[model samples]
Target: MSNQTEYAYKYIRERILDGTFKPTQKLIESQLSEMISVSRNTVKKALLKLERENLVSIENNKGATIKSFTLEEVKNYLEIREALEGIIARSAAQHIKDTEIDELEQLLLRMEHCMKQNQIDEYSKLNRLFHNILYNASRNIQATEMVSMIKTQLMRFHFRTLLIPGRNESSLNEHKMIFASLKNHDAAMAELAIKQHISNVRKTIENNYQYLL
Candidate 1:
């Protein structure tokens, strides 16, 4: 891809993930081209790439629109995430560096502070960073890529989960358990802890999906 196309891709994808572009919202190539200072053809290429990532849809008559998911699709993605994250946690326990573990510990401290201060957005950012560190430590590029792609598609719903009442405290506790298991280099416990964390998030979404909509 050219630099222009890459920029257009990141530009559109970020808006979609951050909810600036609502689901099913039409993506006009000419407008995006003007905004990103790229050609309409370049915007089209970027939209195609995003479609492959499941973040956009293009049809014969329709140009492009942000992809929307059904509740079942969301649940399916979360279930896949739970299994993949468990693998990541297990591998991270075995291969993670001391410095990486220390970073996770410090991040957990910050997350706790965020919870106490009721900084949901800040906590959510930290939560992504926390998992990213684990992803890097896991040394499994394939699984990491797959997890990230799925995450990009579900980013909006994931943030909504954090907005649910009492979810921050529960999420923080879950992260602590995951941190403890990784710090101890206990692969099985790490896997279990992370799986449980994702499972709880899935259940929370299932029970309180209205907030997401």
Candidate 2:
């Protein structure tokens, strides 16, 4: 992609993931072009790319709007995510190196600090980094690719969920358990921990976020 298109894509995608762009908000090419200092055509290309990623809906006369999901669709995606995370956790337990364990430990400490400071946004970013490290440590490229794709689809929803009251602390506790299981090289424990963690997240979303559902 050209620099202009790349900049437009990143700027718009970031806003969507961070909730700055509300669901169903219109994407006006002229407005975005002015905001990002890119041409309207470049903004159009960025919208097309986001549409391909399932993040935007383009109508014949209505232009583009941020995509929203039904409750059932979110649930189905969560189920697939849970399954992929379970496999990744198990593989990480078997294949992770001592250095990777050390890195995870450090990340957990930072996350704990975030919890103490009530920094949900910072904690959410670190939480994603932790999971990315764990998945990559597994060294299963195909599995990694699949999980990454699903994660991209759910990133916005995941960010919204993390902002829920008390969810940051709860999610940090779950990550601690997952890290402990990985440190012990206990494959079954790691797998079960991840499965339970994701299951809890699903329950949390269903119970508290009726608007999202």
Candidate 3:
């Protein structure tokens, strides 16, 4: 894609992922093109790419809207996350280098600082980075992509997870456990830790977002 198309794509995608666009919100090409200072054609191309990734839907009459997940779809995302994240943690534990472990520790320390400062948005970004780094360390291309796609879909609800009372503390502790297991190269322990972490988050969403479900 050209630079303008790429820019439009990224700008719209970021809005949807961050919940600025909102699920089921109509995306007007003229508005997006004007907002991004690109041609409508470029915006159209960007929306097409997003549709292919299941981030948006376009119809002849409806134009485009951010994709909305049903309760069942949300459940499937978490279930898939649980299964794939376990394998990712195991692979990371087996293959993570000493330097990589050090990097992860640095990330944890920063995340702890975010928690102390009550920086929910910053903490959320670091939380994402921590997991992405772990998956990258696993060196499994297909698994990483699968996890990334599900995560992209789940981003809309992620802020809700972080905002829940006491969830930050619990999530931080869970990360510590996963980090410790990875550092020790304990594959089984790492897999179990990651699975439990995903499961906990799933339960939190189920309890709090009954309306969505």
CA-lDDT, candidates in order: 0.92, 0.87, 0.90
- Count of clashes in candidate 1: 0
Local distance difference test, candidate 3 = 0.90
What RMSD, rounded to one decimal, does every model reach?
1.3, 1.6, 1.5
Model 2 alpha-carbon miss at residue 97, Å: 0.7
What tens-digit string does per-residue lDDT give for candidate 3 at 46-145?
9999999899999997799889987667878999999999998999999998988998899999999999999999999899888977987896778889
RMSD of 3: 1.5
Question: Candidate order by TM-score, highest to lowest?
Answer: 3, 1, 2
**Candidate no. 3 TM-score:** 0.95
Q: After superposing candidate 2, which stretches have Cα over 4 Å from the reference?
A: 211-213
TM-score of each: 0.95, 0.93, 0.95
Q: After superposing candidate 3 on the true structure, give the runs of residues whose Cα lies further than 4 Å from its correct spot.
A: 210-213
Tens-place lDDT digits, model 1, residues 1-213: 999999999999999988898998999988999999999999999999999998999997789989989889999999998999988999999999999988999999999999899888999999999999999999778888889988888898888888889999999999999999989999999999999999999899899987686
Supply every candidate's count of residue pairs whose N, Cα or C atoms clash at under 3 angstroms.
Answer: 0, 0, 0
Model 2 shows how many backbone clashes? 0
Error (Å) of candidate 1 at residue 183 is 0.9
